[model samples]
Target: MAGTNVLFTVIVILIYNAYTIDSISTANLEASLDEYINAGLKCHTKNPGLALAIVKDGKVILTKGYGVRDLSTNSPVTDRTIFGIASMSKAFASTLLVKLLAKHSNMSIYTDIAKILPNFKFTTHIRTDNANIRDLLSHTMGFPAHNLMRLDPKLTRDDIASRSQQVHSIHPFRDSYLYNNLMYGLASVVAERIGGKRWEDLIEEELYTPLGMSGSSFMTKVDLSGNVAKGYGTDDATGGPVPIDFAINRRWGQMGGSTNIMSNAVDISKWMLFHLSKGRNQAGQQILSENDMATLHRRRNTITAPTSEKYFSQPQVPVSSLEENYALGWKNGVYRGYKVLRHTGTTWGYSSLVTLIPDMNLGFFTTMTGDDPGYKFRYLLHNYIGDLLLGETPWLNKTTLCSFPEPWYNQSTSVYHPINKHINPTRSLNYYVGVYHNSMYGNLHVTMNTSANTLQMNYGIGSWLLYPKGTHDKFVGEGTNIVHKIIDLSSIQFHSSNLHGRSTIDSVKVISFETRAPPVFTKTSSHVNTGNIVG
Candidate 1:
């Protein structure tokens, strides 16, 4: 029975695609949107659910939901269902900054971040004073992305900001672009300091309340009272989606500006319409000045073909023909002869995309329960809509550009068959069990799980058990923080031997790796000796 349904869905999708190519009327487009989205979602049959909204010419043309909210109950998702929009929250942060600037009058995007975050520091050689609000919005902060540090539930925004000096930069100040979550978090901190309110409350007061986006908020768990969709993650080995716990509220309090807002398609449509109307409320009152809105949309950084290829590989737009640029909090480029601005967000099991075409006055919002595959589905939906609206050829396919967490966990591990058997550690697990610290990220306590004969490293609020990677001294593991326990696992790699060639019995060297960044840690003067330790 399931097989028959799958075949039927495929056939329907093909027919709809053919119709969409020929259709030109807005009525026709609206009529086929449900089928179009359903067809795109067929590739992610195991995903828990999804909700989408399309806004055109200052009004919502379509808002719908697909699949079940949860696998166990089979509860269908509705237009009102809430899901974490992840980095989509960045635009909200950007908007808040613009709004604050309008009120302050004296402030500008060029205002030095030091004015807001007095304690922010950079490495000695770098000109920390040159850093300003614009750098944070355009992601030209010059520092590498250090997302792992932001995953700690215990660390406040101030804690992360104070340690900025500890994070090394790959590019010289304002010379290149690096997508950064910490910078966005810092932007919110600046807003809090200026607006005299929590980031969440400021958003509510300045934007959500006025726009009537009652369904949207930074409170992930509190949003559950509504019809919220359960998030799911794709298993790298099996390519199957499974339920992931929604622990977003715990860690998002401080990082809310980067990836914490929760909202439904219905509410997000209002946001889209607001942007389409150029930041005016329904009453025609200017909520944000037109000049400020334009500032938010102004291209601040140019993204070359190489960076696009490096970040989002296949299924992405050919970087050679089109130029991509980053604005304050949005990504803009030309698509099918129309000016396009879009951004994608991933938080644990949920993924989101918001695209705006100012020329056509069209906007799209999509949210789904899965990781990388969900991203694929989003791009598919965006392309399909774009093709129909722009009267272009159906260009996006299964191979569309998709992104996953760093240290991408794929099926590569399964390819190497065991030669003999798993190798054990050189010394007892206790030798690795110690508190290692990094100035920027704080302490990661490695403890011996005697019962399991394994070593577990705890970073702030989450912990993961380590296992031999290729060698016993070098270990690799995957786990999430205590807060959002979303199935999208953060990976970690550990090394015990001194890569620096300086190790003592009481103070062994340790290296910790997470996704794209690596931080080295050395044992403290004291060590916890478990009886299991052996030379």
Candidate 2:
């Protein structure tokens, strides 16, 4: 009886000590936040809204929202204000697939994609399913970003999974990192086949419910209703960010596991704490062992593609960062002496950053409505919080990093010319009109508007005016609709193939549709021939 009483006293004392420690940590963070957070967010006054959550030593130090949720209503954002988290949703999918794999213990991570997924047909130099879940999650599958597949707004997960057979290789198989979202979406498709549940439900049941993220979901405005923040995009002409249509939110929901989790900072703080823990739920049940967690965070592919160099450049990267890698749904790197697991997510107008330092038990999540700030603001805020917690001096005074992110972006995106300017087509508009097709990307139907005397592309995408370039066959696409800032319009060149002494456009080269080598769509039907096409 005496021993039992002593044990109860000890447990009480331990709980008190933990409470005291958390309180102290919270006080310190609150005291430092006013100056740090306000200064860091000074430049984004024009932005619609944003939310942030910071976790340290398995405690939520802060969860805050800044600015208005909607421009017209002027409703201030709160910790619980829902926002689209974009690719940060990847980690949840990764965990779900891992859990599903554990349930089916016989299945290996190295199990061929063909054998695991139902009728998997991701074609490559090797066998169709030679690449496994690891390759898809790590993004070393050699396929470029066939992002056009997601634009249709009608394709299902099953449709996406089957269409993978059509996308050809741009990089060497298992030899390069390409950051393919479609492949990750396919991973969820694999999970569904093995687990007998839809990707949405599996994530809700397995990850969100376990983590106490009750407010998270695949939001389409209809899901969250009143609480969702409107997304915003930058307009170069207006020189300020504008609120994007709320209807655009529904498009990503159908795109599978790549990016469709809408959540709040308050709930995400719980997610940060979960990672800081030993993969145990609030009920103390072990969902993932330490080894399982390590596997999820394990470094797999090094990110070193030439176009990827912009990520490693200065001012934007964390201080003392040494190398970067792609793990299962996470970017693995070391910033200073602490290990960093991070990912930046941009879903149309919304953008987010999820950073975790497991060894230090520190992480931060930032979600914003506007695309103007991009990676710069998120990077600055995380570094500021990390510096405050680590007892380190501000390397560039924090606000300095946040002040002028525009110049850095200008330097990064200077590779391509602005699409605002257009040159006249080399021949008549009818000569360039055709029904172009790529088995992987589907179809692109080009038609001429006789009234306007301009050619239009009906790639199942928005209305794109084909503005000629270089006084020749080359042309640039300009989206007529303002909301589709996600689509590229920089370069589309027409190639002529002569047959029977007549010149006809046989192919349309897409230079900037998130494609690596910029794939070419062969002309299957021509407007000049009317009924007959090149085929």
**In candidate 1, what residue range of length 10 has the lowest lDDT sum?**
400-409
Runs of candidate 2 with Cα error greater than 4 angstroms are: 1-28, 125-129, 219-224, 246-249, 305-318, 372-374, 404-422, 450-452, 482-486, 527-535
Model 1, residue pairs in steric clash = 247-483, 247-484, 314-401, 315-400, 315-401, 316-401
Error of 2 at 26 (Å): 2.8
Give candidate 1's TM-score.
Answer: 0.83
Q: What is the C-alpha lDDT of each candidate?
A: 0.69, 0.72
What candidate 1 gets wrong by more than 4 Å, as runs, is 1-27, 304-323, 393-421, 470-472, 478-517, 525-535
TM per model?
A: 0.83, 0.86
Q: What is the lDDT of residue 371 in candidate 1?
A: 70
Task: Give the per-residue lDDT of model 1 (tens digit) for 403-429.
Answer: 122223242333423222255765666
